[model samples]
Target: MLVFELVCNGTVNDILHGGNKAPLKLDLRLIIAAESAQGLAYLHSQAHMKIWHGSFQPANILLDQNFMPKIAGFGISRLITEDKEHTCNVIGDLSYMDPVYLETGLLTLKSDVYSFGVVILELISRNKPTHSVNNRLVRRFLEVHKEGKKATELFDKEIAVTMADLEILDCLAVIAVECLNLDVDQRPTMTDVAERLLMLNRSRRSQAV
Candidate 1:
């Protein structure tokens, strides 16, 4: 039997739920989100057989001692055999589920993209996607942006002070908006999203240095 090393930092969900001594900082959250996107990019592109992470959520994502993100739980993954319909009715976490996939049984790459968008929202808002009080976070964020509200106000209080780059935050928010588009066909491919995020991450690092 083969064994894998345990990740030290634990799930992103845990850290968000006061698991850590202090709240996660802004740069750290962005880094983790970017890393998670890279992981998804690899899984979507490098595999000989396409694997759909069926369930991509903060709880399903793990972090290492270095705070690197790793996607786990492939047990529910559906290997795309052909362009045919998959009869499996796998339902992921409700909050992170793609609305299109929820209505239709078809699971596609875009489904993962939608779930990733939710994760991005969570990182920005520091709130759970399924929070009953504010379930339509993405919609509200977009509304607030359109209304000329300060975008930084949407971010968690912990990292509010460090959020100087409103442009970058706006870009990220726009990307998330595209990802969460109601029409799956309108969403950017994981490859495209990964490349864009990689550039963003590099830019952020350069600015930090």
Candidate 2:
């Protein structure tokens, strides 16, 4: 028999909008980002076989009563070998697909990193991967970033951000940018991304106290 734990809080996708529920708080968003990054890091590094989550996104991330994130939907993940070239036809939400992967059909660890970057931006902006205002969130984000605009300008209205919290938001934005680099080699590994987020979350909590 198989049993599944009930995720009382629903998914990251739901929490973002929080239709009837309370919108995701900034601190909770940080915690969710850190936990999701750790979940991806484990799948990419510590698993018996390195699993590449070809379809990582907000909807696939389940949240518990305490808002802790658990990554789901491994049914489509690719099990890759160290020496094996893990390449396949592109399959995933187009809004979050890595340009390099979409064009080359070469799925790599960096591809997941790129997708995670989109999720990060989504969490920060409370915008879908492709919004009506901007067809592609990542491209729009990069464009605004290149124009020397602050990440605070893009922050979701529901998330309360004071002057003090801007630095933390900026740090997360920088990490997201690294993950979304067009050049696959420039992206950081999931482990690195996870650790960086964890540290930032801790710092934010410390400052809140």
Candidate 3:
């Protein structure tokens, strides 16, 4: 028999948009990002039966007493059997849903990567879900990235204190941009994403030490 503990910190959505302006610690947020990426990596690759987190969003990531993230919403996820890659279902939050999946009902591994990218952007900017199909938050950042500018103006003022943090944040933005790439073939796998994030976490920690 298996049991799960209740999360006190609730979902990432709760902490970010829970009608409170109080800041979540940058260090903990970095940890959450790494852990969440690890969890997604497991689901995507290591699970006995490969699972697709059909609805990967901030609202589905729960935090425990340690503020460690546990992904929710597997109940709605589809299992990948053999070499099958997609299901004919249009499921996911509009804000974080992959545009290709929304249109073609072809949910691939890259689809979840796209959603994870949005969550990364949200963490950096503390932005909420954009109900509109045209996401201004994602678009503006991409534009800034294309211009090779740091776009420090878009970083959340509360957490953008140190030069190190800004540099780390810029790298995350670059990763997010890659994840949000229009060509699904160009996006990195969740394993690649998790490794990159873990490297970033380690790099940040080394700097603090």
Candidate 4:
């Protein structure tokens, strides 16, 4: 028999959009992104063996009473060595899965980066990955970013209310876009993503003080 500890606060999705009308504040969002990035970074680099989270999505991200997140749904994960992309049957949600993996049927650590990037986008917009014109939160952000513009309209208005908040949101958007690059080689490592997110959180909190 197996057991799982129930997360009191439910998933990040439940907290933010599961019939809860209250706003998901900027501070909490930053904490979630920072902590989640660090957690994934560990699986990618700090773990004794590299682990691929074949199903990294918002729904799998469980939150405790304190709203701290835990990554779940590891039944499909695989172990990999240095710079190797595991080949397996197509798995994971289309909206969050890496396109490269879909196209090549090869999963790399960067594929996880792609999924995390979608999670970051969700944290920013409060929009489900399936929401939007092209049914992809990533495409909208990329289009806006490529035009050298901020996708403020795509953000959760509650969090992006002020100029300061928008600045922080834009920084996150930059990180998400970087993770979402089509060229797997161009994607930053989870280590880099974690550091950037951690630094952003620290910088924002310092300014708020």
Candidate 5:
């Protein structure tokens, strides 16, 4: 028999899709994002074995009673050696799959980074990655950001807008852009990703006081 701890809340997908209902606060969202990042960082670097969550999506992240994040759905995860840069027969959610992997049948840690970037974009935009207006959420976001538009324009109104919030969100947006870089070598590591989110979250909290 298998026993599982109860996760009172649903996945991030449920919260994002819960229209007309109360949405998650900005800080809470940031917390969730940070916790998820930490979890991924552990998998990618801090763990006894390096792991790649090939299917890192919002649906795969479970929330506990306190709204803390617990990464789930590792059915497709891979354990890799330090020297292994890529793998074959690439597999993952279509919307979150790294384009390089799609083209070369290679899976790298950066592939997971790209997927996480899409998740971050979903948290900010409240848009489904697979249901994007431009077919691909990352491309749309990159195009818009390249136009010199404020990143706040991409965010959902669930979080109240303040100058400080916008500043932090912008910082996150920049991180997201780097994560989605077409060149896998240009993407930040999971550790870098986690640190950046935590710093932004801390800054926001300090400003709130």
Candidate 6:
């Protein structure tokens, strides 16, 4: 059996809910989102075959001592193969399940994209999908964005912010919205999201320096 080193910092969900009095900093969330996207991109873009991480939720995301996100839980993973009989009866978390997959019982790369979109939304909204009441939350979020509402309002209240960081926060919110598009075909690929997030991370780091 292969053994992996223990991550001292626990999971992303634990840190988010530990009542540390200080929530995760906006910059840290950005970095986490970017890193998570990179991992998903790698899984999806493998030249030999694509791997679908059926359960990609915050609880499955472990954090190292440095607070970096490492995606876990490949027990339900499925490889795209020529076998048509290999249908995935098991779906991801209710909050993260792609609507199409729920209806069709077919596991595709788009299902992973949909789940990643939910994770992105959860990161920005600081709300668990199980806690969310309606499907309209994403729609309402986009509507608010269109109406020029202050995007920082979407962040967790415990997180402190400066006026200078508002623009970056807004950009992050917009990206999250893009990921949550109801139509999977309309949503950006994990690879595209990863690249964009990488650019954003670099831009922020340059500005900080």
Query: In terms of TM-score, which candidate is strongest?
Result: 3
Which order, best to worst by TM-score? 3, 4, 2, 5, 1, 6
Q: Candidate 5: where are CA atoms >4 Å away?
A: 18-21, 78-88, 131-134
For model 3, which pairs clash? none
Q: Write the per-residue lDDT of candidate 4 for residues 1-209, one digit (tens) a residue.
A: 99988799888878767986466799999999899889999998989988888678888889988889999888667444456665657766888888888878787789989999999999989888873336567888999999999889999988888889999999999999999999999999999999999999999989989
Each candidate: what lDDT?
Answer: 0.78, 0.82, 0.86, 0.86, 0.82, 0.74
What lDDT tens digits, residue by residue, belong to model 3 across residues 8-120? 88899999989764678677778888899999899889989678887889889999988899999875564544476566656668899888888887777788899999999
Candidate 5, residue 63: how far the Cα is off, in Å: 0.2
Local error of candidate 5 at residue 90 (angstroms)? 3.0
| Model 3 ranges off by over 4 Å | 1-3, 79-89
- Model 6 residue runs over 4 Å out of place are 19-22, 79-90, 131-133, 136-139, 146-150
CA lDDT for candidate 5 = 0.82
Task: Please give the lDDT score for candidate 3.
Answer: 0.86
Worst lDDT run of 10 residues, candidate 4, spans 78-87
Clashing pairs in 1: none
Number of clashes recorded per candidate: 0, 0, 0, 0, 0, 0
CA RMSD of each candidate after superposition? 2.4, 2.3, 1.8, 2.4, 2.4, 2.7
Candidate 5, position 124, lDDT: 81
Clashing pairs for model 2 are none
* lDDT, residue 137, candidate 3: 88
Summarize candidate 6's per-residue lDDT along 1-209 as a digit string, tens digits. 99997798888777766667245777888899899999998988954667777778888889898988899988667444535414557545777776676767776666777777777767767776762345554655677878978666666654436654676667777777777666778888889989988998888898889
Tell me the lDDT of model 3 at 178.
Answer: 95
- State which candidate, 3 or 6, has the greater lDDT: 3
Candidate 4 TM-score over all chains jointly: 0.91
Better by TM-score, candidate 4 or 2:
4
Candidate 3, position 2, lDDT = 95
Look at candidate 4 and give me any clashing residue pairs.
none
Name the runs in model 2 displaced over 4 angstroms. Answer: 78-88, 131-135
lDDT (10s digit) by residue, model 1, range 56-152: 8998889888888889976557454437445357466878887777777777778899999888888877877763434677667767757867567
